[model samples]
Target: MISEREILVLIPAFNEEGRVGEVIRGVRKFLGQSAILVIDDGSSDRTAHVSREEGAIVVSHPFNLGVGTALQTGYKYAVQEGFKYVIQLDADGQHPPEFLPAFTSKLKETEADLIVGSRFLTGSEERMSAIRRTGNKLFARILSFLINEKLTDPTSGYRALKSTVLQFCVQDQYAFDYPDADFLLTIHRSGFRIEEIPFRVDPRLGGTSQHSGLAPLFYSIKMMISLFVIMLRKKSADSN
Candidate 1:
């Protein structure tokens, strides 16, 4: 199994002050504080302060740059800090830190470049709204076909990845906004091995979700366009 020291836990937050702390503590409890980095994407609230108080390494953005950019910042930090692997979870408490160990174990077992946390694989979609569930299925089918591999939940934010994938993500061409199905497809098309595992998600501890409201509809359209663009790109290289 991979040691905790080799792993960096990344949480991207925007106005998630009240809930990010709990997620950080849960990770520290399980991982012994090897490295817990929170990227505060220009949150007007006290996200950075609370994260610091909870003993996390905070990297704040000047303005809200969306979760994808925030995630890239964390990836760059992990690379510079010499972490071998990165485990990212949401700051809103939806992603449980209890499943983190499974990711490391899967890494050791399969050595996959990316390990995606999936709700459909374990039938943990009960927490997702009807619209989200439908969108997930539709995108999953499209991505699976595009990659010629099965994917249950391509939109899941919870995931673990190796340094190789991290290096890929830091490139200028990477998505800076919503990194969902298109992001996964980009990784897969770039020849990174992708795997999925079952993980349970809980409701947010506080605040509304970024995915709520008309955001999902907008995301769906944006993803559709992004996926098409990805398909038009070059094919995969040799798999690692």
Candidate 2:
């Protein structure tokens, strides 16, 4: 029963001034009436200004606090503003606005707590670089094994979340760096329903990925350690 008016389109940007405006406009093209908010993650460029110019409500952080924190900010705003649902998109133009309706419809039909637009799902036409693909496969396997559910794209930023999930995201339990497989596992353990749909993602129109270079290796290591810690904590709690 969530209307478009009750849904917020949240775009998190970091030094993506050249691309954020186009993303905003694209979202507006389809869901023109839906409120669009951009979390400018302390971009040194004109990300905030360009987002504002594109007619999106911009919330700029004082400094770069990472993608997870920026997303948390969006969730906080959604909750405070009384939004019933929130759809997230990247500011780099990889996430297509054309699929916004598909997300909305699927959300309504399934009533899923979270709907992920997965590039690896059936019918998706998107392809990744060999290195990125290999990394994604590794993460996907780990997440599937941990959560006991097959997830094709656990790291995808294109997703829609219900108000309950948004509330959870604003709490202390959410991840702060990359809310990927680890975050999904946490949500699953909490008994939230998650579903994924096939969707194609375009190559980045501009800006560099935060996961490029040695960052992926470091991120993978951190995620593995964090997941282990979470499992141990859960086991202890259950034993008590």
Candidate 3:
């Protein structure tokens, strides 16, 4: 049984000063005193200050690191603090805190090392742009094939991780930039069980997504290359 003391809600924020406070408050409403930590990735804005005002423990970087690094920081904190489970929520309000209980229940029931909140799983319609949707589907299919599992939303950021998998996340084996499909593949290769739960994702409450305009295209291409590289590295390791 996971106690409230053993769980940590980690929110990674970068220039999300307008939305991070709301996200923190929403989580607090449901989580109720469970440790909430905000990783402020060197936001030039007031993200760290707003998060602190909302009563979350804030860890600010000296400069803007990528999302992957910020998330790894949260994982390292969780491990060091002896948290049994870590729930990762985006600072953007796309990931609603209302559905957090579902993640916890699914993780406990399935004993999954990680549980991803997938917007497509429950027929939850979203208003994503065509280019973004195309990139998402293409990458999801690629990752599903590589992992030999049907992953509906490989790019979904809202996820929960057991302590064992959290340990893996902080290690050097994890990805450095975006923790999308490539990171999921790394987790699978490391022998961790990953599952998906149906989730409803709202459009960002405020602030634009990092992957806007040409960014999604670049991100997709980078992730694809990263995925293949990971596959080759794993194969080579297994042969030795």
Best candidate according to lDDT? 1
Candidate 2 lDDT (Cα, 0 to 1):
0.86
Candidate lDDT (C-alpha), each = 0.90, 0.86, 0.85
Question: Could you tally the backbone clashes for each prediction?
Answer: 0, 0, 0
Per-prediction RMSD in angstroms?
Answer: 1.3, 2.7, 2.3
TM-score of each: 0.96, 0.94, 0.95
lDDT digits (tens) for residues 113-160 of candidate 2: 999989987434335777777777788898889878899888888999
Candidate 1 wrong stretches, greater than 4 Å: 236-240
| Candidate 3 residue pairs in clash (backbone atoms < 3 Å) | none
What is the model-wide C-alpha lDDT for candidate 1?
0.90
In candidate 2 the C-alpha lDDT for residue 194 amounts to 89
Write one digit per residue (lDDT tens) for candidate 3, span 24-60.
9899888885899999999999999999999999999
Off by over 4 Å in 2: 122-126, 235-240
